[model samples]
Target: MNEVMDVIRLFLPLIVVQLLLMSVALFDLYRRVSVRGQKWVWVIIIIVINLLGPIAYFIFGREKSSEY
Candidate 1:
């Protein structure tokens, strides 16, 4: 139906963007865990805390560059 199609059109973009953001965050978490030897903690955090886990990882979990 036309109404269904309209709803899909509006919702599709938002869904796509949300998926992209989640994927990006998960990918970043994987990279940080792999590189820093912290996979178990990061995996637990990512699964248990969801979006907040990645946000925290981005803020504090990454390995700091010594050059700074």
Candidate 2:
């Protein structure tokens, strides 16, 4: 039990951060008119690929804005 608690404590913050990142990515994806590739695919990547998923979407998925 002690070891389990230790592991959870170590990973809890990372897990929380990961969820936060995924939530932000998903929300951004929803608000945008376009992304680099298919929106559905990016949604899957952001939701299913864990820490790297949202990062990948943010880095590679977002299309350049024309509003600038």
Candidate 3:
């Protein structure tokens, strides 16, 4: 009860940030043409690895382009 509520409150911000990061990562993945690896693989990674997944995609999966 109270303990559960406290735990949720403590982690709420982290959960929100994770959702935000996943959404942004998925949006970028949908729009971009050239990811560093297979699109499906990246999608799995992003959804499965929680916090680190989207960050990994943003840092490593996205291919650098001259237009950037």
Off by over 4 Å in 3: 66-68
For candidate 2, lDDT tens digit of each residue in 5-68? 9999999999999999999999999898888999999999998999999999988998878531
Alpha-carbon shift of residue 49 in model 3 (angstroms): 0.2
The C-alpha lDDT values of all candidates are 0.64, 0.92, 0.94
Cα-lDDT of candidate 1:
0.64
Model 3 error, position 10 (Å): 0.4
lDDT of 1 by residue, 1-68 (tens): 99999999999987676556557666776555243547677666655674576666666766676321
The TM-score values for the models, in the order shown, are 0.52, 0.91, 0.93
RMSD of each: 4.5, 1.7, 1.5
In model 1, the Cα lDDT at residue 64 comes to 75
The collision pairs in model 1 are: none
Better of 1 and 3 by TM-score: 3
Output the TM-score of candidate 2: 0.91
